[model samples]
Target chain A: MDSYQVGTNTPIKLKVGIETEAITMTYPFLYHSEDDDTPYSMISPFDPAQKPGWKQLDNGNKVNGKFFRVVSFLRFFNSFPDEETFNLAIQQVKDTYEASLKGGDVSPYMMAFELKSFYKDKTCVIESELLLT
Target chain B: MKKIVLLSVLWSSIVIAQSGTEPTAALQNIAPPSSPAFVLMDITPSNIIVPENIQAFSLQTISAFSGDSSNGLSNNNYAVEFQPYWYVKRERMDFFKYNNLTTQKADDSEVTPNDYTGYNIFGDVWKRFSVSMALMNGTFDVLPQAQSYVSVGARTRLLSFKTKSQINDIKSQYTAYTTFMSSPEVIAIFAKPGLSPSEINTAITNLETYKTIVTDFENTLQRKPVFALDVAAAYSHFMGDKNQDLDDAFGRFGVWASGDLAFYTPTIGTNSHVHIYGVFRYLRDGLNLNEASDLFIETKTDYGVKMELELDKLSFAYEYITRDADDNNEERSIGSIRYKINKSFTLNGGFGKNFKSDGEQVVLFGIQWGLDYEPSVVLGAGN
Candidate 1:
């Protein structure tokens, strides 16, 4: 909270503390455009997931839930011309994560995954990563 | 060009292991730090590269280290440096000719000479503090007199604060320093061609012909991350020459802040990469030329921005600058190319155009190199 000088007459000591969590997770997605003033696409956070193009991914492996879904089809759509590929990439990430947990047979597992979507011109890419512990 | 190249080859090889260090950005008397990636922006030298700003250089034997290696960290280190440079440039007016004039006349019809060639050679010895000697000489195409100067001075850091960010491994530091010089006002008068000698002397002199106390705060962020950022701020006060008339020595004060941001793209390979960088600088100057007035209320502010890109060892940079001055406003755009040979050497060339339709054009080329040696590291006596 306070800063002080360190010198021959004034000695100083420093300390740092860190807190770790049981579940370490991240969701990554972005809206990119060549013109910085405008976004490629945006969705209303208040809108319902049931809206057209908004669909949930299959959590057959029980690894995903409302709080930890790998794919939000609508959210990933329309942002890039390769919408289908983007959706597929998200689905593949979910499937791979579930398969890994099921195959590893660990209750509390450590896993990381990424979903990537690129612009039609390939000038830019929006990527997001998730880490599960 | 051939003669220059041969001389450089011979000079560089013979002085491969000079003991001194390159100049520090904190002091305007010395050349600014330049690199292929940050050439146009004129980046500041890091503290490690110019430790003279962190601590004073003193005789190591006098403060000799004990058997305990820890004691060595507090001892003085020494270094020697020698660098020579040549520059050619031209402007619409003989900026250096009427440098000492108190007032300027605005007459477009009265064309004046502007071509110039500058030569400089500097050497320094540093221990607890550092003392450097420099000789600067230059010629004007139309002016009958060529201004030149020989200067010697010493500087030391007065105070400092340093911290590190654990998450990003960013190191931030703030330093305050005072430098005193015995050189005549000639250096200031001739440093810039068109700049009035009075203005330069008033601005360059501290308590002495060249007395300056400066405070600099800087933060260097991670270079491997998505973006690398360096930011710094400085405030300087110059006291006029004591030998000159009180009014003639009217002092000046200045403040400057700058930032350099480099965005790194995903690595293409081990040795090759692409980076886009933007640099910005703002400077404020307050000057008083009247001996009767306590201080000149007249002030000027200047700002500039530079954008650069680097692909492997080749880089290009463009900069735009605007200065609000007393007589007239000045603006210019300059573009430069750099080829970095290694950490210690670089070749640079650049051209500048005045913002005016009929503004002057300038061309510049230079070679930069330096040598550094740490006694403890070189002798393997201490860490």
Candidate 2:
């Protein structure tokens, strides 16, 4: 992947519940990569279909808006059995994700994302990061 | 390992090849003609049938015809009487995945169990890990060597049908909870005392409507509520037949009732596959057959094994039938396995002999053709 050109050509997938609004889906590809040291392919909060403006780099040439990603931290967070237990679990995942970026593993290419769903008036906001290795 | 994989690939290719080709010419020759529609009850002649005939014949027939087997011979004596018997069985089981008790898709449709069209459309619910209601098919037959035969009886269940969209309402879906929570049964389980009658009536009404639609579609008569949302409603006076106008309503549908039938065939026939014990019935019937014989009990019995191979349906059954009276007991052993040629058709051949010393043993060869009815239960998903 290092040798391959990273541009708008990257393929990505969307994770959706059994039923969801089609238009608001977070799609693959529409993500912008944060760093070359990390992998791409992360779940992003911004719906790519809207084509949000990308952040400008110090050089400020618009960075061409190539890779954008989000990570599903659920794989790490759901292992805990309860909410009271999740505070530590969430910190652990965030710390692990941060360490991966510094270790040149996958964080350089990923970004954090959130999913908000309401059932029976119980609102749960799931915080997770998308990463590509 | 590679050869096994390659062989599997080759085998699959052969099966596909075979699946594509027309059945053997023998299939066409043995296939029963659709014209003699009443052939299911046509027990006048000794014959074997093929599966094609069984399928062609309607399931609505009340005939006592047995399906064909691969074996040619049958010593089943109960195939004579036309009386029908009833039986019931229960199978409730559970399902597990990765050892975690996770939420699963429940069969929440509100439909009756016997509605075939709905059954074919909705399929059985996999609620829990239970086969749910795997094989509750009812009724079977017995041999005539015994004066009295036995039949086990069981209850018939009705389904409460509800659509996927209905059962998975948006609120329930988003909540990751069961939409079927509204069911009368579930509501009762989690009911809070002091709820108003109107509030409770609404829930009971839902179950009532479900039962109405299901019975109209499957049964031949109306069924009063066996279980109701309101215990008061359930206990209220029985609602016997001022019943809703239904084309397919049943006479009556009760919960937890059972029935059985017993009869005998003067000569050997195919209904012998009905019971678990052969000698018990013979001894029981022998008491009736050898009455007024305290001094000298004269008796003759046949111990033989027969095979049936009419159609592809094969059976390897054994029978060591015996007859014992006040003074003497006679016994014999008979066993044979036969595979049917086509559906309902069998080519049976077997041998057996009396258990007595110097007993005459004879090889029996004959053809048995008849239809065997198989009942299947269709279930709905849980709420």
What value does the lDDT take at residue A92 in candidate 1? 31
Model 2 stretches astray by more than 4 angstroms: A1-133, B1-282, B286-325, B342-344, B354-358, B361-365, B370-383
Show the lowest summed lDDT stretch of 10 residues, model 1 chain B: B58-67
Of candidate 1 chain A, the 10-residue stretch with the lowest lDDT total is A15-24
User: What lDDT is reached at residue B251 by model 2?
Assistant: 15
What's the lDDT for all of these models? 0.28, 0.25
Chain B TM, per prediction:
0.36, 0.25
Chain B of candidate 1 achieves a TM-score of: 0.36
**Which candidate has the highest TM-score of all?**
1
Q: Which ten residues in a row have the lowest lDDT in candidate 2 chain B?
A: B228-237
Give the C-alpha miss distance for residue A29 in model 2, angstroms: 19
User: How close is each model in CA RMSD to the real structure?
Assistant: 28.0, 25.4
